[model samples]
Target: MAHITLPDESLPGIVGLFNFRPETTGALQLIAETLLRGESSLTSGERELIAAHVSYLNNCHFCHTSHASAAMAHLECDLSLIDDIKQGFNQIEISPKLRALLNIAGKVQKSGKEVKESDIEAAREQGATDREIHDAVLIAATFCMFNRYVDGLGTWAPQENEAYREMGQRMAFTGYVRYAEADL
Candidate 1:
């Protein structure tokens, strides 16, 4: 149950909140679309991974699970990838650039100032462009806000991973803006 009387109580997480305040949904969705689905050197999967990682660090189950599912959809991988990321991405064989960016994202989840000069240099050394780094930070920061919004409101989420798998496929193929409008 949500802390407030959302318009559609059954809709989980941010979706229910969006229904409660339709006016804010467009801006939020636009931010999501531009940051995660927009043209960038980083793949959508990588962006979603950053979002998931930050959400995980925050212990926001809804954001973590949803973004992890989206990451899986974009990467076309199985649940093992999600498990690897949750267990610790360092053990996985992801690109060095992504690992470096994930490091930055993790630091940002704690505090933006936690990102050090050495972190930026490490990402750059791994061939991460300024835009990619920027996006990674923005994604992390945005997800922090989003995770708070969802969990703070006490919104509900489906317990099963299958629900998120369907949501993930929709997010990956439909994009955020359209999905927001459709849901509205």
Candidate 2:
């Protein structure tokens, strides 16, 4: 059961209908909008990768699995990359730039203050533009919040792989929020 019972069909604020309210929903909508819009220079897949990486670091299984699926859908890369990164990215086939970006995200997960100048410089050396580095940090920071929210509320996620895959496809294509239809 949800922490709070919201109206059926209502996309509650936070995950699990806790404090179902418009402002919270609006915030969630805006976050999703910004992520999907790719307001930063990072590709949609890279953004999702950042989210997944943070989720992994935080050990938020639901967010990690869901975002990993989303990343695979958008990037069209091997899903094994997710497992690879989870196990060890140092030996993975990903580019140095991606490794540098993940390092930044890892630092954010450890603690925002832990992100050092050398991290930024390393990313720059790997050819990450200022915008890309900025977006990497933003994505990491945002996912840290998202991971805490999901785990804090203990939201029940759809467990079936098929369900997650479907969600990934829909979200990658149509995004998180959709326009409301006219009432009959």
TM-score of each: 0.93, 0.81
Query: CA shift at 158, candidate 1, in angstroms?
Result: 1.5
What is the total number of backbone clashes in candidate 1? 0
Tens digit per residue, CA lDDT, model 1, 52-75: 999999998888888888988998
**In angstroms, what RMSD does candidate 1 have relative to the true structure?**
2.4
Model 2 ranges off by over 4 Å: 6-15, 78-81, 90-93, 179-184
Best by lDDT: 1
Any runs in candidate 1 off by more than 4 Å, and if so which? 90-92, 179-184
The lDDT, on a scale of 0 to 1, for candidate 1 is 0.87
Cα lDDT of model 2 by residue, 94-175, tens digit = 6789889999989989898999999999999999998888888877888888877776755566654454675566667777
